[model samples]
Structures are given as C-alpha cells and as structure tokens.
Target: MCWQFPLLGIVVDFGHYFVHRAMHSKFWYEHIHYVHHSLNDGGPLTAYYSHPLDFLLGITAPVVLGWWTIHGDLKAFLVYVFLAQVGALYIHSGQSWLGNKWHYQHHAKLKRVYGLFGISDFCLK
Candidate 1:
C-alpha cells in the first residue's frame, strides 16, 4: 500500500502535466490560463489565484484523474492532494530555492516549461 504512493504521484503528475500544457494553448491561455500568468511575480497565495476554469484545468482535473485511475485507499488520495497543493504553493511561491526554477521561466516566457514536474515539458518539447 505504501508503495502505491509513488505510483499514484506519477499518474497524477502525468495528468497534471498534460492539463497544464493544454492550458497554455493560445485559446486556453487567452481565455482561462492567462489569469494565472497574470501573477508573473507571484507568491504562494498566487497558487490558487487563477480563473475558475484554469483552476479546474490545472488543479482539480489532475486530482480527479488520479482519483479515477488510481482509486487507491483514501489515505493515498489524501496524501496526493496534500502534496499536490503544497507543491503548487512551492512552485508559485517565487522562491528559487524550491528547486523548480523552470516554473518561473514559464511565467516569464510563457512559451516553455508548461509542466509541473518537467517531465511533460521534456517529452512534449
């Protein structure tokens, strides 16, 4: 059961990566995802400061995908959600030490670094 945590994270992160990438599409970005990009120099609170649709796409949808696909014990889902939110906050915190410098690049450049863990960016690029 414990081992499932990593697997669940991978699945959820994969879905999150794609959804985040999709949000960067011109149509999506202009209509929805742009709300998030507005916070170019954002802090932790900016993690949730997104258009409702962007939130759904960038956050909720990924969790839902994990819920359906992994459907593990409740503990796993809870841990995933917790970690996901924490990671979101960390990425949006504008703290370089958090280790995801590419996220900052995403906000700054808007054409690169479209994924959460960088896996999608690597593959899609």
Candidate 2:
C-alpha cells in the first residue's frame, strides 16, 4: 500500500510488467487482447471484465508467482492481491493523473496502453 517495500514491489512490478507485455504482443492480440478493446468507453463496472487470456495473464501470474516464491504466506499474497485490485481500479477509471486526464489519453490514442493498467508503457513503448 505504501509502495515502500523495495524487493517485493520490484519483483511484482517487473513480473507484472513483463508478463503484461507478452500479453500485448502481436501474437496474443491477434487472438485475445481485442476482447477488452470492445470496452474502450469502460468504467468502474468494466473492471475485471476482461477476456479469458487477459484474465489469465493479469490475475493468474501473480498467484503463480506467490505459490512459487513466497512460500505461501497468505498475508503477503492477500496484500499483493489488494494492491493489484486498487491499481486496476485507478487505471481503468479512464483517468491517469488522479484528477486530470493525461493518463487516460493513452487509452484512447494508444491501442494497447502497454499493460492492464498503464504501468508497462514505459517499458513496452
């Protein structure tokens, strides 16, 4: 929540970013990513409303990583899950800069916006 934990945050961020990039790739998009594109005018109700491939990449990857590396600490796992949900809410709300709309611009102009949220744009761009 604080974004203060260095190691876990870094690992999770990197994993989410990279995995998300793979999902946005031409191969994946040609098949699954577009299902989400159908909701460009999306809102709060649209959150988690993703295609099956999108859901697998965004949600399953974190759980798999936790199972593999975190030794099954339910607390840490739940925290990560919470943060992910928060991030998704903020990202998909069609807003980027808290109040201003700069971030959401990518959603309209850039087809992929890199990842589920806009976090991967810096790398995926």
Candidate 3:
C-alpha cells in the first residue's frame, strides 16, 4: 500500500535534480569532485574515482531527506534506493552521448561536465 506515491515521485525527482546541480558547484568541484577528474578516460569505473565525501553528498543527501520524510518501511526505501543506483550507473555510463568522447574530452581538458545525464557543460566547454 503506497501511501504517498505522487509525493514520493516529486521528492525523488526534485532531490535528484537539486543534488545534481549541487555537484556542479565550485565548492563541490574543488574538494571532492576533483578525484573523479583523475579519470582521463571515463568509463564504468569513473564513478568509483569520486571522493568519498562527494559520494556521500550524491547518495546520502536524498537518502537522509527520504528517511526523514518516510516512515520506517524497508520496502519503499529499498525501491527508491534501487532506482537511484540504476540512474547513477546510467548517467555515468559512456554509452549514450552525441559524442562518445565528450566525457573523455572533459577529463582531458580538465573541465567539469555539468549535465548529470549528458556530456555538456556551460563552464567546462
């Protein structure tokens, strides 16, 4: 019995959108995100290059908020978590992009890619 499906959807989407935006900020980039830059050629493993703090920010922020909002139910929490993980894997994947090399370009150029779902960046270009 899903008590709050619509609200949960809103929360999840908004959380992802805002959290992704936050990842592009200078503060995040300077400290934690820089580790991922070591990957001059991004691929599946590029996700692992992220600093632990950035990982916490990317994964835990929504989780903490979700925990605060939801009752103690493992089922809903697990589902939300699964979806988030799948999304993360896909976004980090080098498979889908206008150019398969765009991510590598960012790394090679030592610039940031602000698009969480793509290899595009206003600042990094």
Candidate 4:
C-alpha cells in the first residue's frame, strides 16, 4: 500500500535529524558539514552543495535505513528519493513547511532544527 511511504519518511526524518545534529559537532561541522552550512542564504542551489561525505552520511545513510527497513523496494524507494529531492529544494529555498522554515533557520542561525518534519524539533529539542 501507500502507507509505507509515510512510515519510511518518518524513519528517515529521525535518522536525518540525528545525523545532521552530529554533523554540527566541532570536527564534522568544520571539516565536512560546513560546506553546506557555509552556503548560507538557503537557496535552492544550497540543497545540492554539500560535501560528498556530508551528502553520503547526512542524506544517503538515513534514506538507506528506511529502505532497509522496508526490505528493499526499488520502485517505492525511488519515489521516496524524488519526494525527498523536492523537499530538499523547497526547504533550502527558505520556504516554510508545516510551519517551520527549517533549512532557512538552520542556515541563518547555524543552530538547532535538524529534522525534515518538525516533530523531531519539538520532541527532541
């Protein structure tokens, strides 16, 4: 069913939140995630301008977690990938989603708010 997409999205959100928070640590932030952070202003292009490792660990790893959880459904996973891309572009554009201007705040302040959906922001932070 279409149900798994939402479940997968939630899984990815939490996973990404933790990975992103870790990326903000002293070493990783300066050496890796800083590439994304340095690209301030939260433009659409900012979404794609992360360090290779930052993209791998911060984005792909969590997506893989969700895909693995679902036991590897290629078609479904591809759909999730597309949606995640759209989300990345949108959030990086400084637009609010579900009441949170996520990447905008993240880029502007270089502080908290790491999750895609804001549940993790409220619950975890």
Candidate 5:
C-alpha cells in the first residue's frame, strides 16, 4: 500500500503530462488551454483558473484516471489530490524554489516541462 502511493503519482503525472502535451496543440491551445496560458505571471490562485474544457482535460481527467487505477483507494486518492493541488499552486506561484522552476519555464517559454514528474516528456522525447 505504501508503495502504491508512488505508483499512483506516476500514473497521475503521466495523465497530466499527456493532457498538458495535448493542450499545446494548435486546436486545443486556441480553443481551451489559451486561457490558462494567458496568465504568464501566474499566482497560486491562478493555478486552476482555466477554461472548463481545459480543466476537464488537464485536471479532472488525470484525477479520474488515478482514482480508477488505484482501485478507489480513498487515502491514495486524497493524497494525490492534495499533492497535485499543492504542486499546481507552487508551480504557478512564480517563485523559484525546490525545482518548481520547470513549471515557470513552461509558462514563460510555452514549450517545455509539460509534466509534473517529467516522466512523459522523458519517455516521449
């Protein structure tokens, strides 16, 4: 069960990476993800400030995937949700601390660090 937490993180991170990568596409970017990207100088509150479609794809979908894969383990689900929200806030806070600079780079450059864990980017690249 303890080990499952790490596995859950990997699964959720992959989902995030896949959806975030897709959101970069021209169609998705223009129609959905553009709103979130508009906040280049993002803050913590702006972390989840995105279009409904963007939220569905980039946030909720990954959560659902994690929940399903984890066999509905409430503890694991809560932990994932908590960590993901904190990570999102930290990344968007525009503060350079403890490797959060990657997300800042994503907002600044719009071309890199599409994953929370970098797993998808690493595997795909």
Candidate 6:
C-alpha cells in the first residue's frame, strides 16, 4: 500500500485535473458543473452539489481508476477516499483548512485553478 500510494496519487491527480478542466468547458458547465458552482459562497456540503454525472466522472471515477490501477487494499483505499472527500468538503466550506484559496479563486474565475494540488494549473499558467 505504501508503494502504491504515490502511484495512486499521480493517477488521481491527472484524472481529476482533466475531468475537472473538461467540466468547466461551455457545454459541460452549462449542463452539469454549473450546478456545483451555484453555491458561490460554499458550505461544507457544497462538494456534493454537483450533477450526478459530474460527480461520477469528476470525482468517483478517478479514485476508482486509481484504486484499480494500483490493486489497492480495500481498507486503505477507503481511507484515502474518505480523507479526500473531507478535504474537498473543507475546501468548499471556506474554512481555510488548506487549498481554500485555490478553489475559491476557481469560483472567482471559473476557468482557472482547476486542479486539486495546483500543479496542473501552475503548469498551464
């Protein structure tokens, strides 16, 4: 699990970056991701405000793929997923836990700062 952790992280990073970026595109935004952005001043539960398909593609699929890719331990994978969801909740809650600025800025300018850890957005910038 230790060995697979970084690999899963990398896979999730790429998957999230691409899926999130795509969700912001005009068609997707209007139909799906915009539902998420509707709560401009987000709450703890804002992370789950998205369309069902948006949630599946933008959140669940990446983690599932990463787990599958690594043949991850079920317990460890569940823990990782729980933590990630909590992090996203914190981010959207505007609690200043970490990464709040990035996501808030994303709300400010919908097309920028699409990645979780900021690496992909930084490179794109």
Give the best candidate by TM-score.
5
Clashes of each: 0, 0, 0, 0, 0, 0
Each candidate: RMSD:
1.6, 3.7, 5.5, 1.7, 1.4, 1.6
Q: Residue by residue across 71-110, what tens digits does model 3's lDDT show?
A: 5267766776677567555545776654545455556774
| 5 or 6, greater by TM-score | 5
Task: Tell how far residue 2 is off in model 1, in angstroms.
Answer: 2.1
Tell me the spans in candidate 5 whose CA falls farther than 4 Å from its real position: none
Q: By how many angstroms RMSD does model 1 differ from the true structure?
A: 1.6
lDDT of 2 by residue, 1-125 (tens): 23333335555555666765566678876677667655778575466777876778766775567345645555666676777678667767866566525335544664444443344455657
**Candidate 3 pairs with clashing backbones:** none
Model 1: colliding residue pairs: none
Predicted candidate 1 versus true structure: per-residue lDDT over 1-125, tens digit per residue: 68767777666667877887778778988898888889788799988989998788777887777777866778877887888888888988877885878777778888567666766667768
Candidate with the larger TM-score of 3 and 5: 5
lDDT for 41 in candidate 2 is 83
* Regions of model 4 farther than 4 Å from truth: 96-100
Ranking of models by TM-score: 5, 6, 4, 1, 2, 3
Which wins on TM-score, candidate 3 or candidate 6?
6
Superposed model 2: Cα runs more than 4 Å off: 1-6, 70-72, 95-103, 111-125
- Alpha-carbon deviation at 21 in model 4, angstroms: 0.7
* Candidate 2 C-alpha error for residue 16, in Å: 2.2
At residue 54, give the lDDT of candidate 6. Answer: 93
What range of 10 consecutive residues in model 2 has the weakest lDDT sum?
1-10
Better of 1 and 2 by TM-score: 1
Scored by CA lDDT, what does every candidate get?
Answer: 0.78, 0.60, 0.59, 0.83, 0.82, 0.83
Tens digit of per-residue lDDT, candidate 6, span 1-125: 67666677777878889999899889999998999898888888988998999999988999999899889999879888888888888888877755377788788777477777776666666
Q: Pairs clashing in candidate 6? A: none
